[model samples]
Target: MSRSWVEAERAMVRRTRLRISALVALAITVLVAFVGGIAYTAMVHAQDAQVKRELRYNAQFGSPSVPPGCTWLFVLADGVIDDGLIPVPPGFPLHGDLDAARVSGQTIEREIERNGTEYLVLSQPSGAGRTVQTVFDKRYQLADRRHLLLALAVAEICGLLAAAVTGMGVGRGTVAPLAEALARQRRFVTDASHELRTPIARAYTRAQLLARRAAAAGLPVDHRAGLDKLANSIRGLGDVVDDLLLSARLNEQSAGPDGQAVDLAALAEAAVETEGERAGERRITLTVDRPAGPLVVTGVETALRRAVDELLANAVRHTPEGGRIDVRLRRDARGYVELTVADTGGGFDPVEADRLFDRFHRRPAGPDRSFGLGLALLREVVTRHGGTVEAISHPGRGARFTLRLPAADPGVVAGAGAEEVSTGFR
Candidate 1:
């Protein structure tokens, strides 16, 4: 039981780690993207302001005949440069006449291209023989865009990192309480089982001794029967303790070390034999049918044995006197080996069939005499082996419990023949 808690804790830790990492990455990405976009927008606006200021200065100052400043070397009249004015640079468009600049009595402007750079142009009449022309370089605007994009990329990376860290914190915070609850529950089960086992064993032994003495003394046989009944009840309690301890150990070893290979077919046969020996008076017969040669599965032998034992025990306890119990181990269509325990007993509620594997669940329509742990324990065993357990039943018909296990690698282990009763790996 403690082992189960530990496994849960480990799983929680792993999940928390992953969740936190992802969240932190996501948060950081968003933060960086938002900050970088704002920064880029501001940079673009600043570049635009600078370009517009330069254009306004040229318009207020002069024409192509005179340079307003070093930055404004030429201004045009309409679309052409005035005569006797040299071209400021080879890429600059020739200045135009005042008449063209005054067309329609309104300014007509457009962006122009020069020397692989963008320039914003403004054309308006300054006065006679002059037209105001302004051109602002757009290279700085392009450079600002590049810088902004680079900043955004950097911000995105930083955001991702921050998100990862924050995610981890959140995951850990969320899982801590759950882990603690799991640990406490496991401890309770383990401690309770351990404490109950000693008293149950002692009670069973005392009752048996009393019954034997009563028979030897030839006292009232009916009184001895009562003692016998008490003994059986105590024995049943012991069985429950055994199941708890077995579950605890199996859960621990399942994660600590992988189970060794054992012949599942052999195990099934042995379990059948044991069941028959104990339940013969009930007229329960055990049979083994195996078409698949030796079938080896990876799991703790004791746990698997207990699981098989539970299935057979359930069949025997519920099967009517003279009823047949069939135990078969064979390969399924999916290539997995299946161990099935079928009994001609009072079948369970079809609706309750699904809940049989749940711990502490008893069918209201079926047997009133069950601890409800048998099928649950069986499920744990099958799960540890990376297998599955299922129950099929119908009212007034027989019931079947099927356990499916992954087929063992033939190269590593071979199937044991039916003749061999026991093959201990230990």
Candidate 2:
């Protein structure tokens, strides 16, 4: 499958998940706000109702009789502000709004704050010329309301955090099927590639046999040339298939017998020398710089060699004839062994840097030798080795590709192959 189509499928899955998660979170937030508002309002209204009930009871059954913790003021023949009835709390302000409300013969209640305390005052006209005023301390009620508000605020914050976490979980769950399908596709590629190996080997054998016959019989030069080309094509196809299978299977990695300590500096020197010969053929200058001491790592030597070879191969292919290629190995500040290949070639567009490692992503007018799977497989292999790789480039300037592997201590490398087993096939 093409890379774009696979990316589109993943994009669709992510979009669907985001929309579903967003809608769910929005619905939950709205529901929580509605429920909280209703509950808070109910509690406030119930407290007000309790105050009003107390005011009514005091006004009806009391003329000369007064409640224990409540004050009453009268405004009638019998309902005068009788000082003998009850002693008023000090510094209480009597506003003109009270007289206007009594003249309109409407019951009015208002909260008053005095001396850092809250009080509820209710003024009501019981009958003609009978206005009764009562006051109740609301210090405890207001404090309870403040505590409830604080609790509600805390609940809201916690709920939002939980909703965000749940949304992430839901998104993953929703996209599980799409992820599984991609996995199945990779597995199919691996299986098909594995199945085609024997047939390819047989074809290669047949082509070699034909070439040998043409050379001995001297039938025609085209016979030899065409058969050689056929053999080369078959071999290339087999290589491509092998690469595909390896890329698919790299996720399931294990430390095998060949996963012994490797001298990184030595490996790099060998790759440079091998590629130096090829670079000479292209008239490109190849250079290598390394530390005097050995830089070691715990990994498969063949895999690391392939990685360096691929980078150098890319450099040679991209660089113009007589252009320069520099391969360097050094220890980074983080104690990682870094291998860098820089070439004076036509570099790629910077905007596409992020997609350089994606499978089947061929640059426009790229080299014919590339199947667009080299960097992708390189990424998988390096990541499995606990390393990282990146390409740095700018158009019309040049390109530099870097591979960094964590350096291994000499002691660790020495202890690696305590039990030497069979050296397996690559």
Instruction: Quote each prediction's TM-score.
Output: 0.57, 0.54
lDDT tens digits by residue: candidate 1, 1-426: 454667767777777878777867776676677787788778878877776677767677645565544334344444555522744545554344234566645565666677777776666666665566565567768876987798778767767766666666665676676777767776788789889878778878888889889899988876887676667556656765765665555555444214467788887876675566667877677788986567887655666777888899888887888888888888777868888889898878888887988999876555667778889867876887889898999667689999999886764464323323222111
Among all windows of 10 consecutive residues in model 1, the one with the lowest summed lDDT is 417-426
Residue ranges of candidate 1 with Cα displaced over 4 Å: 1-15, 31-133, 138-165, 188-298, 309-325, 331-337, 343-376, 390-399, 406-426
Number of the predicted model whose lDDT against the real structure is largest? 2
Error of 2 at 200 (Å): 7.6
User: On a 0 to 1 TM-score scale, where does candidate 2 land against the true structure?
Assistant: 0.54
Error of 1 at 294 (Å): 7.7
lDDT of 2: 0.73
lDDT of all predictions? 0.70, 0.73
After superposing candidate 2, which stretches have Cα over 4 Å from the reference?
Answer: 1-26, 35-121, 124-129, 133-176, 196-259, 269-281, 291-294, 348-362, 365-373, 390-397, 415-423
Q: Which whole-number lDDT from 0 to 100 does residue 101 have in model 2?
A: 54
